[model samples]
Target chain A: MVKPETLHAVLNAKTVSVVGASSNPDKTGYQVLKNILDAGYQGRIYPINLKAESILDINCYPSLLDVPEDLDLVVIVVPAAAVPEVMQQAADKNARGAVIISGGFREIGNVELENEVMGIANAHDIAVIGPNCQGINYTPNKLCACWPLLTKRGGMAVIAQSGTIGATMGGWAEDEEIGFSALLALGNKSGVGEIELLDYFASDEETKVIALNIEGVKDGRAFIKTAKSALSKKPVVVLKPGRTRKGAEAAQSHTKSIAGSDKVFEAVCKQTGLIRAEGICEFYDYSKILSMLDAPLGRRMLVITSSGGSGILAADTAEDLGIELKQLSTDIKDRLKEILPNQCVVSNPLDLTGDATANRYMQALDVAITSEVIDCILVIFGDPVHKASDVVRDISSRTDKPIVVAFLGGGDVEKEEVLLMHQAGIPAFPTPERAVRAIGALLKKKNY
Target chain B: MHKLIGKALADEYHLNEAEAWELFSDYGIPTPQHQLARSVEEALDAAKRIGYPVVMKIVSRNILHKSDAGGVEVNIMDDEGLSEAYHAIIENVLAYKSDAVIDGILVCEMLKGGLECIIGMTQDASFGPTLMFGLGGIFVEVLEDVSFRVLPLSKEDALSMIYEIKASSLLQGARGQVARDVDAMAELMLKVAIMIEDNPEIKELDINPCFVFEAGGGIMPVDARVML
Candidate 1:
């Protein structure tokens, strides 16, 4: 477990000092300070540089001790050997937390130097994020401590092993309109890693879902325990790469040969209730749905599509992913038949026909919400249906039942309406398979 | 620590097949009734006590792959057959590994009419002790249809491992076959979990071809191996 005070100081620090802050835009130190300024952080920003008197129009100090006020957090971007001295300076200045963005530590086999930095932080009881990480983003406070600045704010908190992947998730949030609460790029992980971050984000009120893109865990047992604890409060979606890697080399038994790290990681996910995403798209798609909608009452999905082909695609994907598509009972089928056209099918997919209008969607959605059998609904716009976004917005606001939309093949209409659906807090996918995959992510929560 | 494991650890060698079976019995993991026979007379007596249709395999620390070395003989239904099997195993083992130290033969009741499954444990670098389960033989060798759960496993975790494999449907009486004793398999898994947790000295364990019988018939481990 992470110390509450440490997490609080790192995430909600009011006064932050950037050690090794530079004047050149090409340097990482300068860009970090610029990102902090551009994020419109309400807190005071202190830039420390030995060579320059000022950076980016802000007065710069020669050392952390030269700072006028007490520092709550320190962002260090100095060389690996300089990090220990900066940490010592941070300790003397009574900084509560530090984010070390420099990368020459343990990653490059500089173990002794990294340990020396850790020793300083530990001795001072100061919480440290990394000695070799990209940095962090706490959107609620408009703090973009890392590079490749992203300020769009919403609900999901992302923690990734690679900074590029973290930025990619942020990019997705910016494009999809479903933003993030926080993002932490854990490089080398010499200090705080996934376990501590998971413990912190699970209780974060602003965070509705936690997304993790990790290569491996340091301690599997500790991870399992922390993940289980987090799952009790909010959903955690994880994408663990290297599923094809073989087991350890010193295998003596058949069990050891097959109990590869990937297989064990899968088991850990299953036991801890972590939603395991297969790819980057699924990771974001899962998080998007989790951050937006509540878990449906059950797995029974009622897919309302304008085309049979789209409906079939949904059924196929849902089947592959273990999302149930039960046949509609005769009573509900008859009710749907009365409102639906005679040519429309009264099945689980409930093909509304490619020519079906937006009004037909509302009718089917109405029957789905009232029906005790239908736990969730998937709406597909197969053509340029008029008022499709309006139908989705009106229908979603009217019910608590989970709803996902696939606004594909509607040309410019879909391109516009999909954005509207996202703004309405309704998960909308560009394809039917992706929409069904999103629904599958929501259904995974109930089993654990 | 179990004396067998302590000895294996001190000697810096894996436990023989018979010793492995004994260690499994000590942990309450079900094993077939049997006894180590040092002589032809002892082999006959052991076969009579364990009943007809017995399995005889060479027990030697030097020879880990008994079947591959032609050190195993099965279905000895009479005293004559048991005696011949006991001698043949010794002869075949010597031919496979000339300097192998023969530790007598393991004569045990032969299992019949059950699904072959494997349940074992190995120390994982990150996860520590992890238990694995899957269909035995070709399924585990070729298809790699296995599932793992890190110890100490809960009832739910153990049960989930049993159903997580690709061939899990076969345990549920797929087609017209009677459902195998999944509860028994789950129970055995829990026992193995506890065993592995209590004995960290156990570096690796294998119970290949564990016979899982009909719904109420229970499961029995036919062969076992332990590396300390």
Candidate 2:
């Protein structure tokens, strides 16, 4: 294991040195420096460049070794040929962590230089993230240590092998208002892999859910073991692409050879208790819901929709997604009848019918949550959006039962309602299927 | 397993199907009443001792696919019939594989009408030993109806793998036919798993057409291939 202090310094470092810090805005070095400053990182920043005396008004050192103070973390944006020397110097100076955003080496059919860097990092116990990738966005200290972007502080943590994919998830989470505690781009995994980062997040107080998107791993057994341990602490939802990926071509044994990529990974995921999502929409939606609420105790779902068509659609989707549409007791159904529209009829889906108000939605939420029959609630509104902020606020502040929404309306007010629901920490979907899918994800998590 | 593998490797036989039966029997895989005879006279004597209506197959290092190579003969009722089958199998295999070195003959009681099942094991690069359970037939690959599971499996995993295939209903007694012994099959799977779990050298194992009789009638392995 890498030193705990080194990982601590890497994650919560107070002083950073951006190696090969460029003055030009077009280069990644300049952007990384600019992002750190823009993100309002309170730590000291030391930009190292051979020529530049200052970058973004911060005084620059000519070399990492030339920096007068001990460094916590170093971000290397130098050329590939120069990375080995830079890593050696960082190791010599006892730097805690280094994020090498430089490209080349293994991706370009050369691994000697990468191996050299790994040797030095291991000898010195420095936690290195990447040498051929993007960077990391740690919001706890506003450490925008990679590409310049808008990252927020919350529960979900995104860890990916691709920098672009990491950035894409970061941007998606930000767009969806899904707060994240950290966004780490695991480039090449030369020195550090997902298991370490998962270990970090497993105990991270800021992180409640982990959204992992990995194509493959160098050590699958280790990955499974670490993921299993992490699942015991917090939910680890994964999206391993390349499902059609076959095994090594030499299939001398038919039984082993026929073990397709999808089947193996599916079984591994099932065995290790990781929630493997289907698509991007499912990825973030499930991450958000799992982060905010505990998995429901059962598959029983109480879906309340304004339109009967949507109610029926949700009922069908609920069944397909493995969520049981619970039949409300007569007393609860009668109480719902008294509170709901007089023309309404109470059933499993519990249609509120057209012209239902946001007030009715909130009342139905209260009734179902109070009843012990249902494990979760799915609120779907078809049209005529009203002030849903109060409804979402009540759901968030009231009973601890998990709630998801499917706002199928299209208008300015409806968009505002969806946005409000997101802001209030309730996962609101654009369709009933997505909402049911989120609940279904919750159901799957319960199996663990 | 090491002892068996050690002896197979010493003999320079990549897979000794006859040796595989003993290993299988030691691990709870039942085999029919059988004996190995190195000559025609010994083959007839063993057949007589076992009772007539027996099966004989040419056990040779050169023959891998027995039926396709004309190395097997069944339903021999007397010494004359056994004597005839013995020379015919040797001649047929000699013509099929001119350089084939004979390793005596395997004589066993001919099984009655029963269901056929296939249980196999192979080493996976990632997950180590994995087991495949399916109905025995030539259509295993053609129909792609087999169910596989990685080893170190629980009883539930074994049973689930058995029930996962399309032929599970057939094993459960389709039409008015008697049901095949599922617990027996599950035990066989678990036994194979434990065997492979200890011996990594057994790279691939195939026991095709294991005649499974009615419920609790017990199953018997007809042929096996253990590749190291």
Best prediction by DockQ? 1
Off by over 4 Å in 1: A246-260, A329-347, A354-357, A384-387, A411-416, A446-448
In candidate 2, which residue pairs get closer than 3 Å at backbone N, Cα or C atoms, i.e. clash?
none
Give each model's whole-structure lDDT.
0.86, 0.80
Candidate 2 chain A minimal-lDDT segment of 10 residues: A250-259
**Which regions of candidate 2 deviate over 4 angstroms?**
A1-5, A245-260, A342-345, A370-372, A395-400, A446-448, B10-12, B49-53, B74-81, B111-115, B138-140, B166-180, B210-220
Q: Note each model's CA RMSD in angstroms.
A: 3.6, 3.8
Which residue pairs in model 1 clash with each other? none
Model 2 chain B: lowest-lDDT 10 consecutive positions? B122-131
For each candidate, report its DockQ versus the true two-chain complex: 0.46, 0.26
lDDT (10s digit) by residue, model 1, range B189-227: 998888778788888888888999999999999888888
Q: How many clashing residue pairs are found in candidate 1?
A: 0
- TM-scores for all candidates: the values are 0.93, 0.90
On lDDT, the leading prediction is 1
True contacts kept of each: 0.57, 0.03
Using TM-score as the measure, the top candidate is 1
